[model samples]
Target: MLKALSLFTGIGGLDFGFEAAGFTTIAAVEANTTVAATIRLNRKWDVLETNLDPRRAVDICSSTIIKDAGPLDIVIAGPPCQPFSKAAYWREDGASGLDDPRSRTLNAFLQVIALTRPKAFLLENVPGFAARGHSGGLDRVLTGITRVNSTFGSRYRVHWAKLNSADYGVPQIRERVFLVGAEDGRDFIFPNPTHRNASGTDDDVRLPLYTTCWDAIGDIPSSSDDSLRMKGKWAGLLPSIPEGENYLWHTNRGGGMPLFGWRTRYWTFLLKLAKDRPSWTIQSQSGSASGPFHWSNRRLSATELFRLQTFPQNVKCDASRSEMQRMVGNAVPSLLAEVLACEIKKQFFGAKLDTSKSPTLAVPKSETAPRRTAVRPVPPAFHELVGTHADHPGTGLGPGAAAGARAKRDALRKFKAA
Candidate 1:
């Protein structure tokens, strides 16, 4: 079996996928104590629960990790990506890129690659890692690899692409950037997408339909957990929103009453899942009004979340509801990881599987979708938010953005007065 080392191994989602694809993860490094404990409970791999930032700690060096894990065929890491994720853009000052201290893990990951000199290494991050303005994080990674090549006289070539999990038959529409490098200069080709939009025309009939939420969790037994029930002032409004829609459904342009302006709210606010469509990306942290709620007008159960991410059935999460959601929501869909691992094995390690065959991890399609839930009338309590609402102006002009601008101006005025 190909031996693997995992870093930032959040609940071992990526590691589990690699294991499914025939790699044996020898050790997993995670900084979160609860998350690391979850991995130890489920898998036999050694769990190192320590801060891995090389700039802060000399005790946890790449040499020490190498000495303990022995020879490794692959080093897989999904370093903390908050510094380069879209969520950062919503902050008052905007995305911090590499400036966020959390981003130090990027260097820590590259250090392991330089020292271990594994045959290949894989890194995963949000799409913003390589965005036009946020390319600093990616530049540092490529530069680190180049320096390693010069110092060690090795030919490590890198390839990277942003992939949506739904395109590979996972039931969620999560997009993430994946980077893979081979020490021997072997070329790595990303796997071709095996599924297409369910609404595709007959002209491109060969590809399978995108896997839908119904396919993943339609048959799941309803949970008794009351925490799964939608709460807050907007709870009653969810049944008014149709499947595959959000708060926008009640906007002036929508089929329902004009309760909101177009693009005024976060996309996930009051969002409800359509049985036939793939799920929206699961948020790592969501408030009471955050959604992609089940069509039953409630929150998705933990089992449903696992199915949408295609986590193997045997793995059990022993945490409370909120923590379970946090860990699961942050995971890379395991099926997507399996798809990439298969390609890496074939292209980098010369595995002899036929290129044309479908991946074993693809979620099976269901024969038919269930009946749509009945829509309820918008509650009278929310009637006050309706009428004459202005749509959000473009980016940097929304209410949140306007509020941030005012705060900045106020600070500047105070500074000038002083």
Candidate 2:
């Protein structure tokens, strides 16, 4: 298995996904004590607890963690994305990019690179990082990774892509940026999105089963206002509907009126579209922002929020409801992680035999071994997710057109070199 080190490891979402994909994360560096504690309790893995802001790059990458992580084959991190997200205030204020302290996380992540000299690394962030005028920061990251690899005698090249989690079989249509860097000059290809779990269902559009609001967590009991675990249906007055079922917990319902309504009804127009079509982007909102979920109703529950992030049923996520919601909204889904890891393995190890697939490290029978859970496959109907190009401020992606993003990235690289 590839030896991995995870930074900014939030409750192990990236760590768990990586492990599930067959990479072993020997060490994770996280600043939150409560969240870090939750990860250790659930996974029993080593954690480096430090609250020093990530911009303090050199300190975090200090030799101690590098030693503990030991011979890191891969490094993975999802830096905080709020200040750089499109939804953030002042984003349209001609704000020069990378002024925010949080934006320097990649610099710190690279500091570790200069020290540890890992063979490969992955950086995950919100799509806004690729937005126009923001390319300066992106270029810094691209050039830094490339130059570091070059100097270390390891090749560094990146395949930067923005992917929709819903298209990859997750229940919600959350989009994020994934930048893969490989040292060996091996072409790093992004994984194919396997499932389209979100789609327009209410429409008479004759596609098979693209996933719907009713599919992923439809089996859970109708949300009750009293239950922190459950919130009343999104449309309180609409006909209660059956979505799907989980491990016999309760009957999941769909399409209920939400708490936020002007006419005692959620925006029926948007609701109708979401019922059958894949949702717009599940955004990285600070809760101070208004459009991440894009419904004029009660917010989605933590578990439901986690569902959109494609987290498995058994893995526990501990956070305040709002914290959980934001966490899921910001994370890189583990399914995507699995896809990327497999690709890296093919490039690095070759067919001589895959280290990721080999179970050479026998699990020591211990009282506290992390329980393995079976992965649920992306449903076939998930690919039916449908959407039109639309962008409303603070909600959804920028018109669903990737037309010039690649070109911009290229031009950005040349600009940086100049």
Candidate 3:
């Protein structure tokens, strides 16, 4: 197993993705009480929790991680981005890279990366990395990493790329920046998205844009199944489901009491099916009655969100409703993680990790699908998923070789966390 470590480990999303990809995280560092509990409950691995902020360099350089898992194979994390978030203060100060308290967390994450001296590392953050404000700060962070690498006589090639979650065949259209690093001159490539988008190739039969939201999750039941019942803490009252089998058949809705700092509003988008398109972005909370979630007036359940995010039927989250919702909202879809994992296996391991083991959207996680004890069959492709993005070469299959099999399976898992 590729021994790894996670920093700024919010609800263990990156940890989950890397693990699914085949790496074993030796330690996870998180500071939020609720998030800590979520990580502890979900992860069987060791997790170190502290509400203490990371502004203090001393505290970060000497944490429990060093005391436990000495030096790792890789270090990964997404430092908090709200301060630099476009949705927050970044847009106002002429995009002067707001000093987000959350951004400071990155200082600690980087410190850990240096200490661990992992062979490879990945730093994930918002799209702000492209802007002047964030770019300026990130430039320093990058330089610092390189400077340290030089001192250690260690060679690292660092590259940054903006990846769209949907570009990889995930149902949602989320996008993010992945800052990838590797030892010396080792070649590490991101996965080629196998799903096509709004733009299509010459073949009309192949999928263009996305397979609709309904197509992504048409197999699961809207209700009446015990597995779909709510398990997390309710952020607000569950929106009343109008008698209907699908979100496409939605109706008018309303508002009521508030939960947390957010008030209740009929989230019309979650329940209403898009016009022959995919549904809105799935959130972490299962019961938020925000728009897109509330169709006509009914709220989308946690199970439905799980499906949209592309989680297997058997994988279940154990946090309270609100906590689970927040965790899911912030998670990197499992399928997306799987794709990243494939890159490691293919590019880093070179034929060691089999890409053919997983399927795409067409196969829901099932007993019929491959399992720990069963012989696995080839996974199917979604009928709507045809040609890949013009940019993606479609898994680079060789003569008489397997094509797109693993891409689809990874995409299915990513949709849920992404």
Candidate 4:
């Protein structure tokens, strides 16, 4: 079996996937005490608690931990992505694009490549890491990797791409950027997308339909009785919002309360699942107020969230509800990781990409049909509650009415908080 080393390993998501692809994890580094403990509880591998600091390049190079292990065939890492994340960028005290302190994590990752000189490396990060604002940081990371490869005379070939986990049969639409580098100068092409958007016009019959939210966790027992249910105004409002819609659906334009206008609120505010569609991205920092509520108007259970992330049901995570939520949300979907690992195995280890052991779900033939024609009608009770009249224009609060818009916006915030 090929030997692998993992960095920033969060609950061993990538480690498990690569192991499933026939690689053995020799060691892993994770700084979070709780996450590292969880990894130890579930996996039999050496775990490191130190942060990957490029400044400690010499000590890391000659570290006893890696020296005790044999040669490494591959190194995989999913560095902290907060510095370049879109969510962070929008935060009040967020990083300044390329200059964030967290950006050093990528440099430390490169320093590992320089020190260990593995046959290949796989780097995973948020899609926003490659965004225009952070392109310089990305370029620096690539340059650093190239420099290391050149110094070692490895002549590594690198390929990078943005991939959506939903296209690999994960029930959530999580997009990430992956950078794969091979030391032997072999060209590395990304794996072909095995699933297509179920509701789109893509006519590629070779690809399967995208996995739906129902396909992932429909059978999981409802968490409504669990202590995770929504409270306060959300309890009253969510049940009335249509499936696959959010607070925007309750706007006056949609024949509901005139608290806010369309597109004024966050996409996940009051979001509910659509039984027929894939889920929106599972957020790492989800809370009671940050919703992607079940169609039943309740929060999803830990197991349900795990299923959406494509983690095996048997995989135990010994952590609290909130910690588990962060771990699952931040994890690379095992299916997507497996696909990438298979490609790496084929390229570096001369191994065939195995599909027989992969999980398979039965998709109905009808689900493959285009979803454009499926229109959900407004419930009659909702229309009555919102005081909708047939002759009235659909416009809720008229545009260009600044004073009315501001009042409605304030009301929306109050309603959301309540």
Best by lDDT: 1
Put the candidates in lDDT order, highest first: 1, 4, 2, 3
lDDT of 2 by residue, 338-409 (tens): 656667766665624353442221111113212222223323342232222222333322322232344445
TM-scores vs. true structure, each candidate:
0.93, 0.67, 0.67, 0.83
Report the Cα lDDT for residue 168, model 2: 50
Arrange candidates by TM-score, descending: 1, 4, 3, 2
Q: Write the per-residue lDDT of candidate 1 for residues 274-393, one digit (tens) a residue.
A: 999999999887789998899988889878888998998888888987888889877899999998898899888889877676666667788799778879999899989878788889
lDDT of 4 by residue, 316-404 (tens): 87788789888877788887887888889887778865466553222222333123223344445444445432332233333323444
**Clash counts for all predictions:** 0, 32, 34, 0
In model 3, state the lDDT of residue 368: 22
- Model 2 TM-score is 0.67
Best by the TM-score measure: 1
Which regions of candidate 1 fall more than 4 Å away from where they truly are?
56-65, 93-95, 201-203, 354-358, 402-418
User: Which stretches in model 3 have alpha-carbon errors above 4 Å?
Assistant: 51-70, 90-98, 132-134, 201-212, 224-272, 283-289, 294-296, 312-314, 318-320, 355-418
lDDT of model 3, residue 241 = 27
